[model samples]
Target: MKTIFSSLFLAAGANAIITRWAPCCFHLSASGAVTGTVGQLDDGQNRVNGPLSPAEYCIADGAITDANGRGCILTPPTSQWQCDTGATPTSGFSVACDGTVAYNGGTTFYECQTGDNGEANIYLTPGGTNCGEITLKADGCGSCPPPPPPPPTTCPTNLNGNYEFPHLIIPIDSSNPNSAAGTSYFGEVSSTISSIFNFDIPASDSGKTCSLIFLFPLQSQLTTSSFTFSGNGAIDFSLLSGVATVSTSYANAPSVETDYGSITVAPGNSYNVATFACPAGEAVSFELKAVGDTCLNYFQDYNPSPIGVYITTC
Candidate 1:
């Protein structure tokens, strides 16, 4: 005989019943799914079936939402994943898990991380920032030259006077009739006449005396090496300007001698006047020599022998 079965009885005898059952809704209520048990069935025989599974799948559109309930999409499949943050790394530009970010060439910055062995975000300060765009280097410290040496001191000018002696002497030979041969003297006179003259004058006058001034003009600068004075002032004898007469008789012979001569003074470049004398007599000779300015003065004397003569004037 045919009989009706409740939902609970059918569920309990799910494997035993072979007859077709009417379709009913299996509602999933708030309390959850109901548990049932039946004998195990063969793998291919009494089982539910559905469409083949796909290698990749996605949920329905907008199925997963964030905390705000706004739908979010996953990134396309790739070997790596990346994020985009506004801040850049300290080092130069690089590819990382995050988006590309620029880095200052010389600046230093850091990020938050745990251990030590991680990517080092290092950079250098931007070149030429504080100092300005520097292409070449500026000069540095160096040494300078020392100051010049001081000038030299000068020497004091010398102020002194000069003088000379000019005279001639003749020797009487033994054979001369009018001369006492043994008493004749021919050597230089023994006196202090040869002593150097030392005197003083004004610096403006250059120690020059009157005679020198009267001879040369102020323009002529006289020096000890250039000029000197001569005469009795230089010695004991005063040089006289005039003619002289001499008459002599040999003490042991019979001949007599008479002589007349004239003396004259002329301008001298370096000294006072240079004197000249000439005596007149027959067979008599004379020699003239300068005796001043050591550079030009020298002793000279000459005589002609066998003279028996007289002179009216010289």
Candidate 2:
């Protein structure tokens, strides 16, 4: 070691010529553990060789003393080498030293820096200070994995909104005289009516549960709604194509039946009517007709104004 550093002391003013420096070797495992130690070169010298993986630095001065001790002399691949005393590091590198720089006026740790020629270099303590010999050790740190992605959005089993006014309402077929009143039948005269309401399911809400909401003002109501009811018990209805024109009878139009098990024609201020699978898009219509003896009055002189109606989907 003395022969290696002897020629360096003869270089110009404050700098020295560095050669024969041993590499501070390290190995990173597949599991992310880092291990290795300072090693000697073929010529056997105690100097440092590095561009350290996690970065390293010294606490005090960048000079080594003569007495042979492991130094805090570590170099990083980056332009600067920085490592705090006790903080969680992003690169997972840690700092360690054999002894403080001022121990008995002797330096146990020394800092490494880049020379003007871009080689690793260390400064020697001025003539008087003693540099002690010491060994170095450090542990590796691994990074944490990323968090899991959020769960998918799900559809609820029940209806979840108030009666919203539909964009369009058209009267189709009804047994009551006022059924001829067109869209007004829903808000005007007392009638057991057949009508259609806008049911546009958004693409985003496809495959989600959906329902039609209604405001039934007056009643002698049945518990369900269907097209072929046994006599005068339940009101009948069909889902027609959204493009179908208004008609006194749409009996022959291509249609789908409302699930009888899902219909509720009972008297109520608000009711969620689940039609067949109400798929997304504005391609379908709801048409209801009161067959036998059911009186569903949307508006009556004795009752308040009708509450608007709409659909709900999730």
TM-scores for every candidate against the unseen true structure: 0.13, 0.34
TM-score attained by model 1: 0.13
| Candidate 1 residue-wise lDDT, 104-142, digit = tens | 111122221112232111112222111111111001111
TM-score of 2: 0.34
Error of 1 at 45 (Å): 99
Off by over 4 Å in 1: 1-258, 265-298, 301-314
Each candidate: RMSD to true structure? 50.3, 17.5
After TM-score superposition, what is the CA distance of residue 163 in candidate 2 from its true location, in Å?
A: 6.1
Worst 10 residues of 2 by lDDT: 1-10
Model 2 agreement with the true structure over 159-255: per-residue lDDT tens digits: 3432224544565443543333334425211144455554455666566555555545333332232122233334555555434344333344336
Q: Model 1 — which ten-residue stretch has the worst lDDT?
A: 23-32
